[model samples]
Target chain A: MTDPVAQPETAIIVLGCPEVPVQQALALYVASGLRERGTDVLVTGNPSVLGLLKVSDPKSVYIGKTLVLETCIGEIVERKRDCTLCIVFAHNDAGIAYAATMCHLLPKSRVVVVVFGKDPEPLAAEINFPCETITEKAVHNPAQLKTKITRVLGWAVSRT
Target chain B: MGCIENLKYEKILPLGASFKECREYVEKNYPEVWYVEPGYKLFDEYIIGLPPIALGIENGEKITFPYTKPCHGTYLLRIEGKEEVERVRKTAKTKKQAGYR
Candidate 1:
């Protein structure tokens, strides 16, 4: 008998508040990288952030599935949703809380916290849980974050 | 008794408890309550504030959430009653309105 086709691994990219200028760009970059690696990507965020992403990727090039932040959390809490990888883009206390919650809920999934903002060190320090973390002080320029993301995802840094 | 400042009975988790701790506490103590996180859309508005997590009990009429003040700490507050719950729900957008499939 022929074996059934296996589903592709899934990765969830949870975004924080959109006030930070680099979050959207980095989120797209990470999603694209994950997709290129044969993993399905779902991006979750607030209305403002989702709206920005929607307008930015009108053709659904980078982001595949999009879910509201609360809905995604609720699904995770209820065990209705699961993924192979979870990446949280954090720049504030709330982002840390979200990442911690993800860690607690998805014990089996690999969780990575990407910390950025005016002061990422302090914000990254607030994470007391066990998870991979990448911190870089960035706002308008996403190069630092991009490099860190490439390293975390095992993608080669683009020369261009 | 005149309208004076006073205290009321409520369950408060330990100070400096993280959102994960608070969620676990509520889930263990009040398993029947609905777990809610930040950015949850109520009626027309979203739950956006400090601490970023909450519990809904009594069919969501009472919302137990963490409130943090600068230099103070995080405290769990339960607001009971249909009026208040309805107020928050009305301000939040529903899943349909939020374009959730």
Candidate 2:
């Protein structure tokens, strides 16, 4: 059987812990990128970001566990739900990607992980996981925001 | 990130790209003048050749792609939006297969 980890495909889950508007803005932009592509964009953030995203009765389902820690591995696996993308958000100088590099059980083809940062150095990439793909997008200013939109659409169009 | 209200480490750091790849991107883009120390090491690991071709870029700068097993992978490095990836094509590089098309 083909290794499931090698082919990742799922909803884009923006992973990050946001405390400031600046950080939330970047993550939101990236999430919007995927959503614009018609792909479901799921944001996995802390209470601050989650609050910002607005936890409605429907979207407010508390995870009660973190996928990274495998706290509910069996349950998450069973409820992996049809995800087409997964974007892990981060801030500048943040190590979001660093932490993700250690995960081994991610379903291949059902995920495209990203660690959003404050800056652009690590923006838009394919690295880390042996079989998985990840990208980093940072939009610090208006010019960068435009670039971010262009690059994101480029990615979506290319994927299509 | 410094002061002005120190954000929690978890809030600052989110696991995403591998450290190796992030470092590679930094070395390829940032101006050579900005390199401090380890930047030179990254250049040595990810850069294609001695005196990398992207004009105006300095030499022997810092690099952070530490030598590690399975570190051999194809990387597209560009500076000022221009690529210097061709300069570092070694005979060994030819043997590596492309991953994540």
Candidate 3:
């Protein structure tokens, strides 16, 4: 028998700056990690990320410009209200701030931040948990990234 | 590395231990951004990206780092909206992929 916990239908990725493609790349790993964990994901961002994902994974993404924090929250809340578990990735500083603000917007939703390092990719963490950083041990290997992503997503989803 | 911080408009003024002083501070205590502690001055134009981007200095070098150095100048930049940042990033990505460096 499979685990009764069905995968989340929506994954909200919120990066702080529209300029950071590196962050977008990191988010892609994260979204991919989530997808492997059986969750459907949707990435939203300014034209930068939206355009990139459009060319990359167009179906599972939503590209928009200037989505107010509240409206973004509403969209996710409604989706989850339909009983689909939802997870959020506030990717960077912008994503972090957005996550904090989002907590107020959707009291029922859960937020996570998987901080990516400049050189070696960092570890992932859920909101309100002890987040690990990459500096401790270089996550240079690709397998480590997948392992970390799956670990973080599982850790995050279990709480909610 | 990515300009992951939110592009918000606020009168955020960062101050520190003369860049050099900050290094000492970090070495002894912890990393502290001089931009906002006690009192730092942000320019009147307050823009998006960040105080660094607004000042037209996007991660090159600080007047002081690892030790105390006098701040020569500060700026209050007009924040560029989301569209503009994307334009630059898009260009940068294309150039980087094509071996612009």
**Model number with the top DockQ:** 1
TM-score of each: 0.64, 0.38, 0.41
Model-by-model DockQ, in order: 0.07, 0.03, 0.03
lDDT of 2 by residue, A1-160 (tens): 2222222223434444544244455555555554554554445543544565554223533221123212222223345433444444434323333223223234443343344445434433423344333333444443454344435435534543
**Tens-digit lDDT track for model 3 on A80-158?**
3221333333333334333433443344544454454343231133233322232212223344444555554564455
Q: Which CAPRI level is candidate 2?
A: incorrect
Per-residue alpha-carbon lDDT of model 1 for A47-115, expressed as tens digits? 789999999999998887899876777677667898988999888766776777788777898889999
Error of 1 at B55 (Å): 8.9
TM-score, cand. 2 vs. native: 0.38
Interface Cα RMSD in Å, per prediction: 9.2, 15.4, 13.3
DockQ of 1: 0.07
Badly placed stretches (over 4 Å) of model 2 are A1-10, A20-22, A55-79, A92-103, A110-127, A131-139, A142-160, B1-101
